[model samples]
Target: MQLLIVTAHPETQSFNFAMRERAATVAARVGAGLSFSDLYQQGFAPTPGRADFQDFPATQSFDLAQAQKAHQQHGGFALDIQAEQEKLEQADAVILQFPLWWGGYPAVLKGWIERVLSYGFAYGRDKTLPAKKVLLAVTTGGIADEQDAQRSQARLQAMADDVFGYMGWRILGLHLVHGPADLDAEQRAEALNSYAERLRLWLSEAVPLAA
Candidate 1:
């Protein structure tokens, strides 16, 4: 199975990076092929423009294929939507890992979803991907209790339903680890163990790779 992990954190040694590493490592151990795109590290450009709405060889009626072609033909990532769609197609499971900033995902990650989950690609009348398949988010927030359903989970899940599920990608999971950086040594170890366990369960149930 192919699992794509998307991380949007600036610090290489941050807890977000560690969670990403742990996720990739366990997924690999469980026999799934692991691939990742570190947005900040890759220098992903998070901007939308007019060319993103172009219609030359094809009409501008929500054609992801055309948008992708236009992006490559024009330049690198004229829109974040096209870039992420390419990644979304290549993976059986997608993990969006980022720190919750200001009650939501970092601006870059949000921009990625806003621009990449386009009309025809992520959602439209005849979109091809399966429902809840993409596995919308893997995120961390400093505040623990506040990340609950009453606080932000419902809103976030609704957004996921609208964006990824609407696009026909089953949300295989939504793992939110708390206090990634604020944890002490013991807490860090416990956090890692918890994350590893959850990830292991996910792979065992969903991924079909050789042991």
Candidate 2:
């Protein structure tokens, strides 16, 4: 499988990065192609601006929709967005690993979705890049109860419809690690090992991207 892991966290040595590393290791062990983006390290912009689009109309008010449409016709976006688009287009499945910030995505990850998953490139009436297979691996400081798990799935499902087409993005799994900071070294190691094992299984079971 061709896999892309999008990770967002400020600290380079955080447990979130550990989880990402474990995931990457598993993918390599399984002989699956791997790609990843560390959004924070990239200094990613969470908000879109005039600079994000090329050949877009010059107006006092910048309309993102118009700029995105222009790019589809003209065949270009900013270098960063273009790079992400290229990786996403080639992936068979996506694994998003991030800490839940305020019960949702970190600001940078939210921005990554908005800018990278642009109109006409990720979605539109005429053309859409649909990711049919997906997985979410989330870490949280607070303890995650059953309700937390349900809510996370609901949120992901909504994103699936909005971005990946109606019920198109099938979540192969959700790996939620609760209170990683409280865990001992052995516990953390066990979590990473378990994650790697589960990830290997999920990749094997993952459905291929739609043709």
Candidate 3:
């Protein structure tokens, strides 16, 4: 099996970094090959421009044929879009790992998605990519206890559904291990163990992790 991991942490020392490490380690142990895209370290640009939409064939609407023609034009937009598409094609599973910032994904990661998951690709709906293979491996500094409160749980679940589920990816699960700012040794171990176990379970089961 092959897994694609896209990480959006700006710092190498962050818990988001550790989550990628743990995920890669577990996947390797299970005989899964890995490919990673580190957005911040690679300095991926998120801002979209006319060039991103350039060579976009004149069409009545955003349709598959227009997108295909645009993709055929080899240039800045096509190159970057092809790179992401290649990664997605090469992997059996895709994992997005990022720290939850301001109750959502980092802007860089969001930009990567916007740039890469173009029309006629990830979700043209009619031309959508196969959804079951994609999953998420998210890390957050917020404590799990905080997520357990009724309002917080509802909000987070909605976030997950809208981001992953709505986008057609089956959310494998979230690694919302908490307190990076104040983690004790025990807490750290507990978090690692939980992450590893969940990783194993996801690999073992063929079913989607979302409800």
Against the true structure, whose lDDT is highest?
Answer: 2
- Please report the candidate that would top TM-score against the real structure: 2
| TM-score for predicted model 2 compared with the true structure | 0.87
List the RMSD of every prediction in angstroms: 4.6, 3.6, 4.9
Supply candidate 2's per-residue lDDT for 42: 92
TM-score of model 3 relative to the true fold? 0.80
Candidate 3 clash pair list:
none
lDDT of 1: 0.68
Residue 100, candidate 3: Cα error in Å is 1.0
Backbone collisions counted per model:
12, 0, 0
For model 2, how big is the CA root-mean-square deviation? 3.6
Tell me the tens digit of each residue's lDDT in model 3 across 35-88: 999989988887654445546655446554454535644433556656777888
| Candidate 3: stretches off by over 4 Å | 53-69, 72-76, 125-128, 143-153, 206-211
Q: At residue 101, what lDDT does model 1 achieve?
A: 77
Model 1 CA lDDT for position 189: 81
Ranking by TM-score: 2, 3, 1
Rank all candidate structures by their lDDT, best first, as comma-separated numbers. 2, 3, 1
> 1-211, model 1: which lDDT tens digit per residue?
7788989999989887888888888888888887778889877766644445544344346455556545444545444445566667777788788877777778888767766665545566655443435554445455546546355667667766766766667776676666566779899888888888888887777765455
In order, candidate lDDTs are 0.68, 0.80, 0.69
